[model samples]
Target: MEYRISEPFTKEKFAQLKAGDTVLLTGTVYTARDAAHKRMVEMLQEGGQLPFEIKNSVIYYVGPTPEKPGNPIGSAGPTTSYRMDAYAPVLLDLGETGMIGKGQRSQTVKEAVLRNGAVYFAAIGGAGALMAQRVESAEVIAFEDLGAEAVRKLSVKDFPVTVILDSKGGDLYSEGRAAYLESRE
Candidate 1:
């Protein structure tokens, strides 16, 4: 089923989502990649303030290209998610509620999601240009030295995503495959 979800996700809102559900997300989504993750984790370790509010916020794992004339952002697309696995649990423990990216997360991250009542959404891979259109606005919010890998604050309206992992421990990556194999029998 499809649902419309907003940023700064609440426990009640996320609890309704299950793996395999389609969602149109409308609100702010911060962009961050591997380098940014490393920095954030280091900052957390040092007891430094994060660039943005962590509680219930969504972070999109993307490194968008330079914007063309008349566009809010360039080819904004999800990068591999596993690269952030090392830092995810730490962030989740601090109240991060959502992540948008491509591919499966590590078991550690999946467990963290359940532990923290968070959800992981999979944005369509290889659809950068299409994804960029959904972004209403984008601006560098932190880590400017990282260029495309810089942290960006994006205002997205009706951005499409699918629930890959939900707080209930529902996982589409494994469940989908299981269903497909079962159907062949």
Candidate 2:
């Protein structure tokens, strides 16, 4: 089924998600990559304030290319999710409720999602141009020196994503594979 989720996801909103569901996200989402995640975790370790509030927020693991003229953003597609696994549990513990990226997540991240009632959504990789079209506007919010790796606040409309992992521990990857194999038997 299709779901349209708003930003700053609430418990009620997250509870409705299940693995394998399609979602159209409309609202604000923050961008971050490896360097940004490291900095944020370092700040946390030193008892510092995060650049933005993590509570009920969604973070997209992407580092878009330089925008061409007349575009709000460049090729904005999802990065590999495993790159952020080392830092995900901390963010989840800090109240981050959703993640948008491509590829799989670590078991630790999966556990964190279940414990914190968070969800993981996958955007199609290699669809950068198509994804960028959904981004109405974007501005760097922090770590400007990191260039494309900087954190940016993005306003998106009808951004496509698939629920790979739900708050209840449902995982579409394993389930889908199992079903496919079963069908051939």
Candidate 3:
């Protein structure tokens, strides 16, 4: 399942991904936390071009702390995903195929994913130190005044993530946890 992000995602690849499937997301991923998403959606509504192409892009909702010397980013992990739900449908319609964040997405977003053939992935919410190791490089792309909320271009290597919601109405977080709880009972 190791593949570069630039490659066209085949149905086979998508099929291989399920809830809790771990992946090393390499290639270019853009950081767009709350503020960045709001601004991006605003620009889209205004009919302005996005700073980066939305087609087949992967947006990671994160606001990493300032990195120490020789580090790519500090505690780089997913933030709550629901915050970006308002903007996700628009991005999905624009051809954005992948999203990485924590927590549940709104039902509207889930419906949009089903309609658009997109996938929602989640990284460990508090595992920042572990996550930082996977990110090899980072660069700011837009909204510099937003500080950590600025959109950043991240180059990651084998960055771990789990598929939370698949394109079809399958939700991993709920099902997976329920399965574990049921087994225990």
Candidate 4:
């Protein structure tokens, strides 16, 4: 399903996405990894305002390498999501609706997703070259001193991803693996 972040993604729209659905993400997606997540959470704890609104936004957990000439970003791909687990619940509570990363999230995050009507999407872990093509523009949004770990606002086109975890507690990785193994047996 194709969507632009400028509008609210309805629950029905989110429900239409399942494992293996192709997505064209044509809107602003915030890039953040472990360091950025930590800072954001710290700010929240201190009662500080966030640089950008998290409500109905998609947070892409990535630390893209520097772009070469005529490129938007370099080697863009998702990092492990487990590192962001500690801070994710806070953002979720603050109305962040979607997350893009690889690997599994903690049980707490899964519960938060269910309770918050959020979804966890996964980009191919090692497909950096393929992922870079989807990025149309990139600029640092906050925490610029963090270098590659800085928060970035990425404008992407036809950014492909899979729904690894859904708001209802459905897990594609484990379920798909189980089905594959069962078929071979």
Question: Model 2 compared with the native: what TM-score?
Answer: 0.97
lDDT of each: 0.93, 0.93, 0.84, 0.85
RMSD (CA, Å), candidate 1 to true, equals 0.9
In angstroms, give how far residue 169 of model 1 lies from its true place.
0.8
Question: Could you arrange the candidates by TM-score from highest to lowest?
Answer: 1, 2, 4, 3
Query: In candidate 3, what are the lDDT values of residues 9-36, reduced to their tens digit?
Result: 3333555566666666777789998899
Poorest 10 consecutive residues of model 4 by lDDT? 1-10
By lDDT rank, best first, the candidates go: 2, 1, 4, 3
Go through the candidates in order and give the C-alpha RMSD of each one to the true structure: 0.9, 0.9, 2.2, 2.1
Clashes of each: 0, 0, 0, 0
What TM-score should be assigned to candidate 3?
A: 0.91
Better candidate number, 2 or 4, judged by lDDT:
2
Candidate 3 residue-wise lDDT at 85: 92
Residue 140, candidate 3: how far off, in angstroms? 0.3
Q: What is the lDDT of residue 116 in candidate 3?
A: 78
Model 3, runs deviating above 4 Å: 1-12
Error of 2 at 97 (Å): 0.5
